[model samples]
Target: MKNLIYLLFVVFFSTSTLNAQDFSDIDKSPMDVTIIRNENHSPMARVIYSRPSKNDREIFGSLVPYGEIWRTGANEATEVTIYNDMTVMGQNIPSGTYTLYTIPNKTEWTIILNKKVHVWGTANNYDPDKDLMRIKAPARTAAAPIEEFSMAFQPITNGANLLMGWDNTYVEIPFKNVE
Candidate 1:
């Protein structure tokens, strides 16, 4: 009887541990990171954001709305870390991590880099006073619709253009390294 009880306890504890170790379901909007390197292949800047799928719904103007500030991605506010000083749209931005925000319009989008970080969804937490710089980037229609929101760095002669697209709209923010 003692041996049987001990065996049962072991099985119960093992089962409980296994269940506890199980992971939860994947996030609906998964996190993604995109990094850009300099001429020597050294990291220049990185963007950490969550990609939310279109799911057959209207993204811009309807779901996201126009002339309103967007967190630039889902879940936590999108973060941009610059390893060195860079010029965005001819405006100088120092090396640091900043929250990326955008105001999308049909003609163009206002790209904002804010000093705030570690913020959740932008409900009442966004403060305009913390903004470091704001630049306008023209919005263009992509040939194909992107199912998921995406960001990529397109290499240029001096630096790289940070491309962002979702649904059918796309925008590019140019970043030039300052020597």
Candidate 2:
């Protein structure tokens, strides 16, 4: 009887633990992260943004629109943290957290780094005067279609490329370490 009780308890506990292991995303748009590491393997810069799936819809020049400011992600404004002082597109930005916004076009995209952080969707209250810097990057065609919006930090000689792509379009913003 004692052995039978122990066996039942083990089974019940194991089942409960298995149920607890289910991690399901409730939000249609899921948050994602991109981290740029230094030579020492420590994070030099990081970005937190949400990924919005295409879902058979037009992504650029239609859903995202052209020549308009976008929050650069889904739910909240995309957040970027710079661990150390860096130069982005020839403009110096001190080590700190900031909101990343973008104005996308068919030919090119303008990347904007703002001093404001913790902003919610679309940056309705975005102040142009608070902009740290704005840089233009030419758009490129992706080799394959990207169904979902994604961002990545591609390693480079001095720093990394902040690459954002969706629906066959690719945009890259370069960031280089200051010291």
Candidate 3:
């Protein structure tokens, strides 16, 4: 009787502790997103983009600052790997990966293009001159927190539009198909 009670107690306590641990990333993660494109140029163009939800303790500022280069998001900079040339904001961007940054404020934020791609955000190897484009867009407030950062393309007449919105902000960058 004593041995049976002790065994059950140990098993139940251990199971409860393990279950208490936060398994937040079990179903949802930053890597999960809908990659939309209008790649008719043959091999299919690709662009990688990400939005962050909780940064450290705070949402935007603490994890992602107002005036600093964020690795786009937590862990590493958010990456957008492109397989071909595309025009954004009326400028031609060649086939390569680029790190997307934003200057966030109450109303508007400017999107950035740094030539260096596939690196951690805030790695400090960025050059402003290599920036292919900068386009300003409006940020909209949301009633609730967006648990996941997301990026997707909306089809347009001339090209595919990269629409980004999360945590009360939105931006659109048009990627014109390279012809």
Model 3 TM-score on a 0 to 1 scale: 0.67
> Which regions of candidate 3 deviate over 4 angstroms?
1-29, 39-44, 49-51, 55-58, 61-63, 123-125, 142-145
Cα-based TM-score, every candidate: 0.88, 0.85, 0.67
lDDT by residue (1-179, candidate 1, tens digit) is 99999999999999999989845677989999999998788999999999999999989998899999999989999999999999998899999999999999998999999999999868997899999999999999999999999999999978889999999999999899996
Work out how many backbone clashes candidate 1 has.
0
- Tens digits of per-residue lDDT, candidate 2, 71-155, equal 9879989999999999998899999999999999999999999898888876465878899999999999999999889999999
How well does candidate 1 score on lDDT at residue 26?
79
Q: Which prediction has the highest TM-score against the true structure?
A: 1
List where candidate 1 sits over 4 angstroms from the true fold. Answer: 1-24
For model 3, where is the 10-residue window of minimal lDDT?
27-36
Clashes of each: 0, 0, 4
**Higher-TM-score candidate of 2 and 3:** 2
